[model samples]
Target: MAKADITLRGRNYSIACAPGQESRIVALAGQLDARLQHIASAVGDIGEDRLLLISALALLDELDAARRTARPSPEMERKMAEALGAASDRIEALAARIESGG
Candidate 1:
């Protein structure tokens, strides 16, 4: 457990990572910087923090949309099908009992 100091864009940040993870941290920081710069360029002039927050929100929105589009998990689908089958079985049993009594 080692601490590394990194300066990204115009701010200094201290990150904690295991040994030899500084490069990974640096690369991720670079990607974040590039994304922020791109966002700033697309929109009008704004504060760095504001732009950063907007970028984060944009990413979250995209992920939310993707989640909405994805199909339900197989286990969930199976459970739903089972529930429907059970309801169908109950209805059939009720109909049979009514016919027999009549």
Candidate 2:
């Protein structure tokens, strides 16, 4: 496992992930924090736990919408499959690099 040190909302956390995934994990945390900040701005000073809960719900809502709208034509499906495969290859390569300590 690799450890990533990241700061969100002025707080620091050490997160562990599969080696090369540290940057991606940090990026995800940043996205979550941005959502939390937006919620805070709109609603004023909610407690930390409530802010986090609301932020999660907001993101989940987005995911649900995306899932619902993702019915694609055959050609578009093929293209999306290709893109996903390429992304998978890149992730595998990054994992290999981390495993080799490169």
Candidate 3:
């Protein structure tokens, strides 16, 4: 096993991973820390727990959107087009708000 030390929101965490995966773990933590920082800047550090929840939801939303568009069958694609559009719009609006520091 290998351990990676990462800092997020000014706190440090040591995470264990496969021997060769230490760098990947560190990179993932970096990405997560970046997301947390962006959210904190936008919302003014509501709380670590809340910020984590919001960040998780945002990531899940992106994953869901990606899954929905990932080469679905023609019928499925047609059925999902409207819903995907709505989701994309909502995601975009949320991103805009965050970017604008709201």
Candidate 4:
């Protein structure tokens, strides 16, 4: 894992992520900062905490919308199929053993 020092609203914070994913984490943080600022500026000088909360909700709404369109990756689909096939075979094997009075 790696961590990056990020500054949002003039405050510095450390964020950690899995190896090779620092870029994505940082980019997401940047988007959050921008969204928060947008919220703060939109309705006039709302306090930082309130602004952050509102922005969080807005971001979560966006995430929920996108989740509706997300699909499993090809690798995940293949692995899932393999696992299902293995489970089916195990169940069939047990059924045969039980039927044969073993």
Best by lDDT: 3
lDDT of 4 by residue, 1-102 (tens): 798777787788898878888788788888878877777778878788888888888888988989976978899899999999999999999999999999
Q: lDDT of each model, Cα atoms only? A: 0.85, 0.89, 0.92, 0.85
TM-score result, candidate 1: 0.53
Per-model RMSD to reference: 10.0, 12.2, 19.0, 7.6
Better by lDDT, candidate 2 or 1: 2
lDDT of 4: 0.85
Per-residue CA lDDT of model 1 for 1-102, tens digit only, reads 876676666788989999999889888888777878788889978987799899899889988999987978889899999999999999999999999995
Write down the worst ten-residue block by lDDT for model 1: 1-10
Give per-residue lDDT, candidate 4, residue 78. Answer: 100
Assess the local accuracy of residue 11 in candidate 4 as a C-alpha lDDT between 0 and 100.
Answer: 88
Q: What tens-digit string does per-residue lDDT give for candidate 3 at 1-102? A: 789898987899999888989889889999999999999989995988899999999999999999977867988878799889999999999999999999
Candidate 2 C-alpha lDDT tens digits along 1-102 = 799888878899999889999989999888878877888999999899889888888888998999988879899999999999999999999999999999
TM-score per candidate, chains pooled: 0.53, 0.67, 0.68, 0.59
Lowest summed lDDT across 10 adjacent residues in model 3 is found at 68-77
